[model samples]
Target: KMHRTVLALVNIFICGCFASPPNFILLFADDLGFGDLGCYGHPTSLTPNLNRLASGGLRFTDFYCTSPVCSPSRASLLTGRYQTRSGIYPGVLYPGSIGGLPLNETTIAEVLKPMGYATAAVGKWHLGVGPKGMYLPTNQGFDQYLGIPYSHDMGPCRNLTCFPPDIKCFGLCDVGVVTVPLMHNDVIKQQPVNFLDLERAYSDFSTNFITTSVKKKQPFFLYYPSHHTHYPQYAGPGAAGRSLRGPFGDSLFEFDTTVGNLLATLEQTGVINNTLIFFTSDNGPELMRMSRGGNSGLLKCGKGTTYEGGMREPAIAFWPGTIKPGVTHELASTLDILPTFAKLAGATLPRVQLDGVDLTGLLVNRGKSQREEMIFYPTDPSEMYGLFALRLGKYKAHFYTRGATHSGTTPDKDCPVFAVLKAHDPPLIFDLEADPSENYPLPLVGRPDLQKLLDRIMKVKAQFEASMVFGESQINKGTSPELEPCCNPSCSPKPSCCHC
Candidate 1:
């Protein structure tokens, strides 16, 4: 009996010694530009909470979202792979769209849940919906999901005949409007409510979930993807005309408050130190409403383009004792989140192929750069956008049909349809480090080595494009292979790192 008692004490001690892993909270904002936050640089933006976070955590200067659009960006973030790999290669889906995240692809939540983490997603879920296998958040591995299936502006307009009628006037249109009912798991819990209130409600719900999880001694993963500052911007009830910068600015302030509330909740629950919080935007600002959103400072272009404004974003990671504070100019992408989270949680990701490299080392180690080269592609065919952009070292080469706008609102309508015989384009190279805004395209007077680098970039681009096509083909054939482990033959080998 004494021996058994001693063994029990040892077991209890071990349990106490091995505390649960830190909880994870990913706070993602929709349509928030890199300069919208006070930390990143906003002359008039009041983001005290986010500013505090920057002062206390690690801020990334060169972080890029996987896509320049919403749906694809989220898909990339969730899967830690290019959205094209999962067949989400364009604008967000409407209710009838058959495309959503493929079921075969594993999500971070799904991978972490089995490791004893309580996973919950409390915000926008634009991946897909309806009778399709892709509609439900539960199907995607989220234990709890509470948000709209897509963007707040996706519902029918309050007045069917009104061109871009006040979406809030009718409040959460289920019929002619584009926005749908708020969903809880598979069920629509609330029908057609104001999206601003919906956002606030989700914030509250997220806080409550975190509090409950902490009480239960369960490590939790909460994905709070806010619909703040997105198009048809609507602030909460009392926040109308609250900012001098218009609806967009008002929406940003409200979003900041929501984040403050979450942080306060963490402190109240005594889990602030035991939590890892990541904050970033889905993509760059929507250029259609440029005044509504801020710029990426010197970064050129905004939303829908392959430019830095469209892909680069303000990224911050906060873990009291884990991630050191201060600025990190490392080139990191949204795709790195998955593998990083998995590593933190001691979760094993499937051996499926992925384009993202685990950036845990970069986050934990202040002096390391996560990647040396990154390729950006615009899957949207509308703008006649570039097929791919290769960022190697300081040089960025954009390879695309020069004249295509890919849905861009531009004065020039007609241009060349010629494909580059070689990936190297004399007019396409830009030294980003020297010209971050891409203001000056480098004069390729006689630089053959630069041309070679561009050629290599195109070769890699071809390989990736082929991979995307093959993945899509597999998906269509219903033979989409499951994600295997990183070391598995099915998975791609890790990318080479650049410690610059």
Candidate 2:
């Protein structure tokens, strides 16, 4: 009797130690706009699956990405720290960029690794490219990786830089001019994957990962970062010309179907109620693409600007049994994802201070948002010193003004409306609650004019300046000979690194 009791106790303890935690599927879209999804008020693009997910869970209307571009926003999403703090400050990583999310930073995957969650990173991983294994996803806590290393357009374009100055040139002259290697964990699975099949492959990888993880009885964290809707728009087979909006719309449609299938997989595994799913974008659409560029709806400018449209990404969180289905206008940023997941998984947050707060309460319908403000920075690939926008409660104050007529031409510094009366000297304030589009600006500094606002801005700026240390961006850093994949059948660089 004693032996039986001891065995029972030991079994209970072991099971308790490895009990199933909630699975997380972070479905990240590349350059998807706030107004692109049907749930977010897009008129045409078929995103039924995403809309359905939103209807089943909580949809956030005013959710923002940390930056107006990709790598910085992704870094912030993973670490719950500003890109400036995470060392990806100025720009996006390129094809063979040396620098990546610093090893010191504790990623969300790393935090959940201790809980025995099976983690996989699928699709685009613009963080870094490698001959060195350290920059790959496996080293960064992901158990498996199957995807492209950077933006798809980075491959050789037949036309000028593969941007295709004319829409007619798309898929004709310059699409997939350069070959992007298909990475499977640290090895190059395919020398150059056909762009036409990219979307379907990503979907297959994701669902397979989930299926395998479930079979192993392991809770999983699947980071599916789609590589569509950026530029050089190529539609995967069966998705071509499917949307009325052209290639961009086709990509959206494919993504929606992919989401639906993923949800279906979760349901099939009998873990739909235990899985936490998130659908959001790295940033807004690329307006430079003109007709091919996505509309930001009522929001100001598109990607690369600090306007609402640039930073405000469409976001949806779904956990069938946990989150109540409702739309939240509360201010939320991708930065909050880390701490929220930490709390959900009962994982330890890093000892260092973090920018994001725990949003588990809001997720559970327990309380209002703990976040009240957010700071907007200048566009990357430009001079750093430019206008900064501060959002305090309902009022958004811009210390400097830029003549942002459209997406790309926003000036590097504050633009002058007059010869002497500099518009930004007193700061231009807008009531975002009244004007979500940021059309009209309240008159410059008046009696008690933004004194509190100025004080708050100064305080945060001072703190940032005091502690912030800028890291060298690896953008366009020449691909080192050592970073090249070992193509020889008999030779391997390192067993842990990439082997062709």
Candidate 3:
């Protein structure tokens, strides 16, 4: 009955022959916090474009990423499975990491590309890039790709005075292995990419893809994962020190403008009505950068933890004619993107245990979210891919709680990084709807009324654990010199290494 109902809802939009399959543009942000945008309540980081986007589209207050860090979170977003299920566990993959997201695990691009969609990917491709660059986005079903294979800040900075002073690690300062390659279709175009010109380059890449695809009358999917609001932040041309909230705000302002430019291109090309744009972050803020990092709003902690602040993101879904504009507090995740896009393209899901519930109904008709519960995976290496927290309805139970990596010892008791490693017996539960800050814990030791809730949660957890078949450990496979994206094997490093 559920399957039949889902098919019926899908037919309501695609109707008859999947007429005019909508274009999908997933604008994924890097380390953007919930409170980073004015729409989500950034007091000073004035985000006019993003604010306008939320006003004109649907905003999700309770949206999330599957994991709190880069590679794992991206894996789940693309595959619609938990990061562990896809073997991107134990935190993010480094530049020369030998392994990547398993080739067998199907991605959103893989699902859509075969359905006659001209797929292009831009910005950061952090999932993995090694083993002869076989793990890059081009191999993962994208027809065209441009940008760095990993975080731009992974390599040592040439100069720190241009970046935020609070930035802790000046790009793997000691090792300095990641000389980020600016690649286009697996070919290196630039090394140690000039960040200053990144905004203009990205704009040209995305707009050109949109324009060319439209001219060919091909439905397109552009997954533009941006490099914004992360460490070593720099504003785009004409965007520096403009937000008045500091350099972080400056970068955010430029990101908003970049998005605005895409929207304009869609409008100019007369495809705005047929485009489905999902704007969200890969994970939460990086708290180590202090003022250079993003704000999690009322949520606890930041990147590299299971806290809401680490995983929860600001989400906006815009479709000019189809989707009704409004705010939804219903639970959603980046995991749902694959299933939802599959449903949109009339494609079948890959034969595997997918952890996402399609949000087509909620996205198109303002119906209730298909999801009721959420499982939070630990992003901190110490926790080792364990289930850190569970959210059943409004109540969230934290089986284990820890702080972000490099967060250091702090006097802030509200931060909640315990000195000792003792698992909770009863589990600290919170009514997230009421206390979004996670300051007050609902003591479960003596509350008989909460026993049933806990039981229900445990039952689900047990089921998840029982059916789990974790994929091969890709991240744990140590980095190899063979995986580095050095264009010339003979050169020393950048500045002299492959300039062309």
Winner by TM-score: 3
Assess every candidate by TM-score.
0.82, 0.85, 0.92
Task: Encode model 2's per-residue lDDT on 185-282: one tens digit a residue.
Answer: 98877655556666778889889999999999988999988877777666655666678887788877877888888989999989888888988998
How many steric clashes between backbone atoms does each model show?
A: 25, 2, 0
lDDT of 3 by residue, 128-224 (tens): 8877789999999999999988887876665533333323323443244646668998998877676777777888999999999999999999999
* Residue 177 accuracy (lDDT) in model 1: 27
Off by over 4 Å in 2: 1-19, 159-178, 381-387, 401-406, 409-423, 444-450, 463-467, 471-500
* Reference-based lDDT, each prediction: 0.69, 0.73, 0.81
Question: Candidate 1's error at 177, in angstroms?
Answer: 5.4
TM-score winner, 1 or 2: 2
Best-to-worst lDDT order: 3, 2, 1
Clashing residue pairs in candidate 2, if any? 156-177, 156-178
lDDT of 2: 0.73
Off by over 4 Å in 1: 1-19, 132-134, 159-179, 381-386, 401-427, 455-470, 473-500
lDDT of 1 by residue, 33-146 (tens): 777787877787767788888999999888888777888888889998877667776566555454567788888898889878888998788876645335568899898888
